[model samples]
Target: VGTLTFKDAPSMVTEFAAVMKKMASYKHSIGTGDTNATDETRVVDGKIYLIINPVNYYDIVARLTIQNANGVFVTNMPFISPDHIIQSVDVPVNKLIVFIENGYDATQSQPEKISEYKETFAMKRATLYAIDMLGNGKPVDNYAAQVYDIAIPTSGGSGE
Candidate 1:
């Protein structure tokens, strides 16, 4: 994990908008071997990289997405298991990282939003973030009752 210094919220928001415009032409990839695969972790002239480590409780599978503050969808990673990490490269700064409770049925009408974090990431830094659920025992149907937290790993910390 890299050390990150928080930028002023107002300035960061402006910068994020500009960066998003610049990134309009860039594409993102999922796994290796895709023709359109773009290495997000590669040091770009004006972008940041993020690695999200989601810690699940009660052996639940988490569905996560990244969205801008205006609720615009950026990207999503479905079915992230416990302790699994997802890397997003050249991401726009000051976006919201959201986690939704998994609804096994593919045809389910709506998925519930359990937790979210609005972050202003440091430029040129590959930052590691951990999202964790807080509660004891198994979860019930009302996922909104559950609490979640997002944090940066400390020095030498694995965020386990």
Candidate 2:
């Protein structure tokens, strides 16, 4: 078996404005359907936005690994839901990729074990994944819509 590398689409550049717009639009459109006020809460730092979904709060535990170009960890271990605003050392845009390994129990699986082929971001469509960071953060994917540009923002103003 080959070493698994976490790679994301270079075209999917999601901006802060766009992310907020999505959340606001969802809230506006589903004003009455929103059962919980904390259903969706996000952390916006310059451009990088860390969002948690309701499912992560209600059920299921997903392990998320965010690494910079230097391969430094961004988010903490056993990432749960309802948490927001993740900031760390400066890393170039797009250089900060995310690897989310969900589904199986944590006690049975390791978070760093991405090579296990547990599930990919694209593969988890239309399932419990609807409550993941990308799903809950942006409602576009929840509607079975194609999301390509998920641009992660950097800490410093240096737009590389």
Q: lDDT tens digits, residues 1-160, model 1?
A: 1122213334434543443333333345544455875533222222222233333221111223346799985433222232333333432232223223331123333444354434546423444444454433432122211122332222333446
Q: Over all chains combined, what TM-score does candidate 1 have? A: 0.18
State TM-scores per candidate. 0.18, 0.18
Score candidate 1 by lDDT: 0.32
Angstrom error of the Cα, residue 81, model 2: value is: 10
Q: In the order shown, what is each candidate's alpha-carbon RMSD?
A: 22.5, 18.4
- Ten-residue region with minimum lDDT total, candidate 2: 1-10
lDDT per model vs. reference: 0.32, 0.30
